[model samples]
Target: MGVFEVKGGRELKGEITPQGAKNEALQVLNAVLLTPEKVTISNIPNIRDVNKLIDLLKSLGVKIEQLNDDTYTFQADEIDIEYLTTPEFKEKGGGLRGSIMIVGPLLARFGKGYIPKPGGDKIGRRRLDTHFEGLQKLGANFEYDSNTNFYKTEAAKLKGTYMLLDEASVTGTANIVMAASMAKGKTTIYNAACEPYLQQLCNMLVNMGAKISGIGSNLLTIEGVKELHGTEHRCLPDMIEIGSFIGMAAMTNSEITIKDVHYDQLGMIPQVFSRLGITIVRRDDDLIIPKQNHYEIDQFIDGSILTVSDAPWPGFTPDLLSIVLVVATQAKGSVLVHQKMFESRLFFVDKLIDMGAQIILCDPHRATVIGLDKQVPLRGISMTSPDIRAGVALLIAALSAEGTSHIHNIEQIDRGYQYIDKRLQALGARIKRID
Candidate 1:
């Protein structure tokens, strides 16, 4: 609903701190709903989606108090169960994809979970079958209302059992793990998602007295406890934002230091970017990208064009593919960006093409970007953000462009990033938010 008027070709140089992991915050905030005691969390990003989830929790009668600028305590001692059946609950909860996570904590604590069909970026087919099917495996009766697209679950007693997930679905795995934490018996989950977000969730559960093992492995074993307690947890820094900053630095020929990246949890993200010929150096915990006059894509050992694709854990995240693709435009070589997870994310290349970048959209899943080698500067043009990751990619493109650029529908950008314009301004980039 707003626009960013950005003056392109500014070489930003400064230290920018990454916000707390948005994905992890979504799961962790919902975990507070599992206990009646006060749960305090720090480093929460002040973004739209997170604020909406907090609002949704508040509407359910969860007592929330702000402890600091980026810290809060939540107490879900008295939830209004009757509100779950209301139209407002369905409409408001459905607006956020993270809201589906509330179902897990609700089911564990209250023995009933009512969830509206959640909404998120329209990147690809993000099915909720993993969530419902995993919950059903834990002895919950699943019922779906076709007209309303609401999922209602109930259980007299949730008894745990061994189960193998269809995939390592992050949210699905988190949901099932939360449900199993309060079940009657031991639960063993194979093919679980072991992302840092899930590990942090498991650690938080353990802090709250839930018995869980295999913290960073796909196979996990959980022994259900009778109850959970309040705990304090801190979220890891946002890796996606750090990766975006690396891409932004490369495209604009800028030197930047991404501070306190939690390098251990990054898990091959830096290496993946290095594969694109971007010069990256690590100074203690921070990742530094120096301004490069020219960088070339690396070929495979067998002498084939490099393919950048996303995989499960221990692989490059699918979320950063857009940034990777955009930064490749100004590099010194050609690389194929294979967006294996989402089909529609690659469609944003048309906007970059209009900006004079030579990119070939091979299909919905693949695009070959021939780097300009900084020979011709991209011209800034008007564009609308299609999704969160693509929006940042466009912002990076606009910053590297030759003239002023106007980016509309910047709300998509705001949903994921926290005070992005102010942060850019601090880095000496000229960007104004037009309301």
Candidate 2:
């Protein structure tokens, strides 16, 4: 496992560019398998999870070429469908949650798909029922082998039908939409995830000859097409990373400009940060977060305690709740961080409490952070990262603490952020990777 040695009490300054959207990259990469033509993708982040998916695609015989550092061209014309039966495929597919998405495209083009139970963050029970259930509604027969924990779906020809999703899951919606794109009839998905990631996927699919409407709405209509052709796609900048940078700037009292963030796509992120009393200046596509000595959390209009909760898109993102919790540790007032989506995400608050922050773990789902108002600086301590978001949140806390902090299991952090230590170093942050 990798570790990060972050020395605190230093301010980071300079322009830091957010990487390509990790969530979007995972969705769009799998979309390439829907077409036989060359699909070129740019702004792909060099992260572990995305790389793992790319390698999985290669193992399934997708001809992938590197156009540049952050660009790739993929052709899935010569896929080895039998490769899915190999133990090697099960091991590789089981390692990544995003690998489950490949089954959608493979099923659409090749009539059958197989995958081992996928693995990802240990935040909570991330069920695959959403993905498999949605696919089953599209005329695919779903079967599970409990002994091997493998999932298989097959259909001679998928005939689309209207269905209402139980939850507007982003990955679930993406998987279903991909399969439904090539189904035999019109498919309508109500209460679908309208996140920017899903919007990008819909737009890319439309460009590839799939007739998809309702680009930014909860209701989507896809007129099934016989085939889809490849096209170019550029992923939006990671909004989660942008939000983390905003919190980092306030916590460290640093003036940092995040470049080319695709601000409009970052729904509710800026407003949520502003609620924490942080100033965000927009210059073209960049967000300029000025240094602050002491930022204050805002109370509700009724003078109630401020509550920061995550919801579906257009609401605050759950991924950034950890960052919000960490940033609130140095702020001037108290805020309740409610992580409604994942039960175990708030479990990392004990580490912040150990760092001299005033935080009360209300439960597995909520934490009330009483800001120290910068009166007492957080002292660094050794900690282990539990998940990607929590790992980055802990890193942000370490950066603002009084002394040197050691964070173990930094591979969790690397799974999402690209060259995070190097990026922070470029911005003058005293961060090092100790492998």
Candidate 3:
């Protein structure tokens, strides 16, 4: 396992650029399988999970050419569809949660798609029922093999229809939309996930000749087309990373600037951090977070304790709740972080507690953080990263603490963050990668 040796108590400086969206890359990269034509994508993050997916595509015989470090052109003109039945495919497919997305496009074009049970962060139970059930409603046959732990879907000709989703799942919505794009008639999806990443996917599909309406709303309408062509796309700056940077600057009492972030798309993120008493000055597309020795949490309008909670898009993202929780440890007031989507995400608070943060784990879903207000500084210790989000959160904590910290299982962090230690080191942070 990889480890990050981070020395604490130094304030970071200089400007940092957020990488391309990891979530959007996963969705759009799979969308390349929807067409046989060439799809060129720019600003793709060179992270472990995305690279693993690219390798998986290569294994499926998708002709891929690397244009640069963060760009690729893929053409699925000749796919080895039968390779999905191989043990090698199972092992590769099971390693990535984004692997499930290939099923929708494959089933639409090739009549069949197979995948092993997908794996990702062990934060909580992420059900595949949303993906399968949504595809099943679009006239695909869904089957699960208990003995083999594999999922299979097939459709000769999918006929579009209206369906209401049980939840606004981002990946689920993207999967069903890809399948529906080539179906027989109009498909109406209510309660779809309308995140900016999903919107980017829809826009890319539309550019490729897919008839999609309601690009940025909960309700989407797709008119089936016989085929989709290819188009060039550039992913937006990662909003989660942008949020993490904001929290990190405040935690370490540093002045930093985040560049080229699509400000309009980052709904509620800046406001939420500002509620934690962080100053975010928007200059053009850049966000300048000035240094502050003490930032306080804001109370509610009724003078109640502030509560930071995660909701679906158009709300604060759950991915940054861990960052917010860690930042609040140094604020002047308390805030309750309610992680509604994942049960096990809050479990990482115990590690923060060990570093002397005043946090109360109310349950599996919520944490109450009482700010030390810099009256007491956290002393660093060795810890293990549990998942991608939590790993970065812990890294932010360690950067602001008083002593050195060793973080094990940093592969979890590398899976999402691209050259994070190097990036931090550029900002005067003393971080080293121990391979």
Each model's lDDT comes to 0.93, 0.95, 0.95
Please say which candidate is ahead in lDDT: 1 or 3. 3
Write one digit per residue (lDDT tens) for candidate 1, span 321-429.
Answer: 9999999998888899999888899999999999999999999999999999889999999999999999999999999999999999999999899999999999999
For 300-363, candidate 2 gives per-residue lDDT tens digits of 9999999999998888999999999999999999999999999999999989999999999988
* List of clashing residue pairs for candidate 3: none
Tens-place lDDT digits, model 3, residues 228-292: 99899999999999999999999999999999999999999999999999999999999999999
Better of 1 and 2 by lDDT: 2
Which TM-score value belongs to model 2?
0.99
- Residue 81, model 1: Cα distance from true site in angstroms: 1.4
For model 2, give the 10-residue run with minimal summed lDDT.
125-134
Clashing pairs in 2: none
Model 3 regions more than 4 Å off: none
What is the Å distance of residue 120 in model 2 from its true position? 0.7
After the best TM-score superposition of candidate 1, give how far the Cα of residue 424 lies from its true spot, in angstroms.
0.4
TM-score for candidate 1: 0.99
